[model samples]
Target: MAVVVGVLAVAGALVAVTGPAVLRWWRPRPASADLIHGPGMWAALRPVLGVAETERRRTWLHLPVTVGEAGARIVLRLPAGWASGEAGTRAVDAIVTGRLPGEWAAHWCRTVAAPYVEWVRNAAPDRPRELPKSVEWMQTGDPLKIHFGETPEGPAFVHTGTATPHIGVSGETGSGKSSILYIPLVAARLAGWLVTVIDPKQNSLTEADEKSGIRIHSETYECVMAIAEFFVSMMAAEKYNGRKYRGHSGPDSPVGRLLVIDELPSFREYVAAWWKYIIRERGFPPVLVWFQLILMQGRSSNHRVLVGTHQFSLDVFGSTMARDQVGTKMVVGEVSIPSWTVAYGAGAPMVDYDETIPGRGVISLKGRRRKKTLADGRIERAEEIQYAYITPQVSDLLDACPPAPAWWDAGAMAPWITPRDLARADSAAAVKDFLPGGRFAGGREDLTPDTDTDVQLTQGSMPRSEAMSDVSGPGAVSGVGEGLAVADLVEKVGAEGIEEQRYTIAQACAVGIIRKKPGAARQYKSAWIKEGKPFPEGEMIRGNASYTREELESVFGTPEEDADSI
Candidate 1:
């Protein structure tokens, strides 16, 4: 027992000490001593210049750059044939300049000093430029491409088109999936190809611009019928009066048509029905498919689908349809996913199921040709996938699209009101005139004069004689800040009884209209009362919590626009 305990104690001690040491060693390192190239410059060339030990062209390095008073610098223990000749000089210049493209040019400059200099600028075949607006197509790397196992491992990874791209996107709810999806839509639309999108969550598809030639609909029977109609349209465009597929002419040419549906499982029972409708009734060939989960259960052998999910099902590869049809499978988050390649006969590597990797993913790539003389003169096995950052680009075009029309404003809830409604509707004072005393019996009625109105108010603008309820107990406003407490704000707006007020505030915060200060409570202060005496526009009154004017402006914008923006 003592010997066993000693062994156990040794094991625990090893885990406590060595485990952290190993982790610390593997952790992403900060830029230390200078590299011949800066990080941005290194990133640009990573795809071209394959790493030394790895058989593939994707170069994985742990060089984190910190921008400081002295500018940005990256430290790396460069390999042989690196840091030689004019390219080396250019790399130094690029680091000093702190510009990417300039660094890229310098890193790839002609170098007679190194025989392998030509290999440093190796360009991967360019993939189709048509990708979503939100997804910026940064340079490709073997680690990124082979990370999926769709493509073979090699120095040739960049410019490989989205013909087969494995994307990994991570964001919380309400963090803008619509914005992310828009990029591929733009790409497909520009390429004169059709994009079929399935958004089961339903939030992202609403309010997308119609002019962009996308067909957005809910996951309903009617929506399925519309999808059938779209299939028919594609069939007609391709068939050419029963000639052949992929052959089209006239105004009905299959140029650009994307069918987007949100909330897929809502119509899960209708999937087989829609398939029959498309194949038997409509007869459409698939161009591109975006499945944000839901319809991923079933697959078709002909079309390509981009399956996005927080958790990927291993069952995906079990189907021949998924293996044969789905070219690119993109797992979005660092969540646990079932191995798809094992079922599909593809040797895709299992991703490290580390839930704490932030926004990393492992994709199983297939179909690319492998090389013979790479890893120790042995051919690297297939199922190689690469890691690439799916960084979102903030575009004003997304904001231009109108917010989805709410259910509250629907026909059943209320009659549609345009700007003309405000001009034509009778004032609240008009309605109050007919009421006896303009006050309820048990309620407090202060007969304050209408003369104490702000410039915007008038005698006739008193919405009604105050319908004030009785003041009960010590009702005090909670917390402190430049804006009213959520409850108090609702009460001040006379929406105390309305359930939608809280939701309204939440939505406003979601879309960057109002700033929701977390950790500390805040309060409301009116600029009207203070008359500009070091006025803190919107003060977050939590003790020891303060922000500079520059920070506030950057986050919530000028205080005047906050309410309206929300």
Candidate 2:
């Protein structure tokens, strides 16, 4: 019996030593499915929870696990010490890694009132390319509903009138900035909003403009004028917002205005002069001032601005108020870290800047009453979305609405003058002195004659030969400075002759025959003198001036009467 007891005791001790090890080796390793759910998850989590046994009860409340096609998400809530900072976050991360499968990703978020740990697993499958629906089908009564594109989760949209009135789009070249613009323009048109596109490069939005009939302004001057006109319209809307008109979108309500400015850097470069003036005068550029007005008052007046730029700087926008007022911000493919911050703020997603996927962007919308829940169960204000591809048919849908007219053409509030007009006016005035009848052509009539013979020639009617001799003599020297006025020339030529030639003072001025003088303000002079012509001694009156025969013959070729006499 003692031998039997000794053998049993030895067996019991060996069993205690090897049983746990043998059971562990025999047990199944945690598969993906096991870690996702069932009793396997709790069994796996128990040991990880034990690592923080002192704080486990306070830190971890419950684990909510959800599995989807994209991946599996496990949310851990910390009810008591949720506000515990980075230390608590690190501790949770440790527990998650210790407990979950090796492939899972842990993202910690501090909510408004509490903190939660989100653990994600599995790679997201490739999302199929989603083409935009027809504009007619996408139209909704809600002015705020702007359909952006589809994501793996679902379709994405932004609220304009009710939430925010501006959108900022930032991307590298070929990063699908045009796609984002095209989609919004279509949406705005379908919604009955008048659309204006300011494209400095002209190529970026030209296709859409031609295909859809959206009004496009490519010239810097045209764009500046258009914005000014639009600002006036916006002011009118603002004044009538509550009194003369209702501020909602409908057939009876006042129409809304949507302005899309593309290639903002190019536009800025083109308008650098305006910027310089603004800085020198310590005033805002008129466009930016009006843009700010639209932003501040547009929500009620139904005016909105959407700007796209490759340059991602607040200074590029000119005003911090304007930059900060943008309600929707999108950053696409390969932007610098600073650009990312400017687009989506400091806590933006950690995106791979080298990623070359066009249309893939981080979109953040402000003033959203409802936030979307990510796979990890954290509410997300910003989402990773792929904008819809704009197809030819979609562009064709824009044809249904007639293109909005250039903003300046919509009103007569202010006279619009182009640089070309100013240049032409200046050129016409510059060569006035060198023309036929210029300001310097006429001499002063009050100057005294140089000789008594000149006085006799002026006062007496001598024989035609004697008169001719007197005109050619030194006594007629005073007549060289005293040139005939246009009125005096017409009178001497006879009204019939003047009419036959179809000549008038206005016509003479237009054809460079005469110019206004600085000495007499409204007086003019004849720069041209008929060559070989005897001076018109008969037309020389007290208030009128006459040229000497020699002076007349020098510049204007032989006179009709003088040639007849010869």
Candidate 3:
């Protein structure tokens, strides 16, 4: 009887130790959480297991390391060698994540030589983050620092000054993506900041009341034109000053200027839909090129961009080397695996990201000081937050913030007005100095986009450097120049003409059209010259070679031949 009693005692101890894990394995929460401690991760790291942590060894690069088991984490100073690039990073993630208990994961701080991957076993508290309670304590000491949300730790804020200037917000529809912008925009407006809005949806925040020092652009085509004009205006102002442009302070402060672009993807769709017609056919508008420039150099001038969208990726901002330039990026509402990847970018480990709570999600900011990882289950890259809910009453408070007495208007001039906003002698004289006959709104809200008019390359005079000047010749402006022998030579040959837009570049390339950006159209001239063929339609605009699609089709085969080859 004594021996049997002892055996039962041992059996009871074993059941007590393993029962919860066994039960958790048998019936995981919501079915998806079953693989929380992914055993496959261990198997996935098998190839790299030779040098990484193994059954008996913790040495990496043959160096000694430490191991400690805390409440829920196996704190291991293991091989960071497996964390080299993206593939190696994933392998290390498998190792770190294998240690967590609940549906939680782990991440190493952003350093290669850093010796440890942080882990904690606690199931992160699943309560929704509430913003209304924290509103009274919201200390926005810096006007440039705009408060948008709240984390369990404190109020969430982003600086839009010289240091960290732009903010990017992305989430799915009804995911509070647009809701996140209300506080910042309203706060900035209340602070008497000059606000420019591009509202593609034309519903919310589309109307700009001058009483509040706000201006808005609504149509798709108008937005492009406005962006281009703003870019040129900045350049012109910088040139006029004979100094590097600065917007926030000094005598010529553009500090009052702030641009908010909602639905950034809308502009990108416009480009994708009309690329062939816009570029080779009708002198490309340079939308993404100039827009990115604004994001990059606009900081020095206090020109800020607060942009929001449904999806966040490189293509969304037209290939943002300026992505880092944006400074603060947040994926709000119930964050998804895909959004967490694109929003925070690669190598950011996401644990406990199943945030379905409204106005709450994850955010990553540039230039933040390194903080010690807490046992509370938040990593540096994947910091969770609850955005300030812009309740109607709170909006009433924001709406009450008065506008600045001084105001600046982008549409103070007319479309037909001369480049300098002064009287011009005549159209012919204007032609000599200015590249006229293109759409120029100057931020006029009344103006609609004119597809018939080409985009005006610049607002004011672009000084003709010998580099900026093109002469009429095979090497220069081929078949394009007033009073040139090339015109008569073209007449004698009775040149074959075909309409531009004969084939999209893909179709053209099917029959072999070699053209890339900046010169996607110009390459045709070079190709013709290479074959010792005459391209009688190559023209030079502002020193860049411009080609009409009609001319390209005439030289290359027609659309029928191009399509047939495809």
Candidate lDDT scores, in order, read 0.32, 0.52, 0.51
The TM-scores of all predictions, comma-separated, are 0.32, 0.49, 0.49
What are the per-residue Cα lDDT tens digits for candidate 2 across 141-259?
46678777654456677887554568878888888787778767777776657777887775676555433324575644445545654555555555455654444444333467788
- Model 3 scores worst on lDDT over the 10 consecutive residues at 474-483
User: What is the clash count for each candidate, in the order shown?
Assistant: 40, 8, 6
lDDT of 3 by residue, 368-424 (tens): 556434243223355767777664544455446664433232233122233552223
lDDT score for residue 229 of model 3: 49
Per-residue C-alpha lDDT of model 1 across residues 281-386, encoded as one tens digit per residue: 2332121131321123221211223334332233322333333333344433343323333322333344443334332333333334553233223222223223
What is candidate 2's local distance difference test score?
A: 0.52
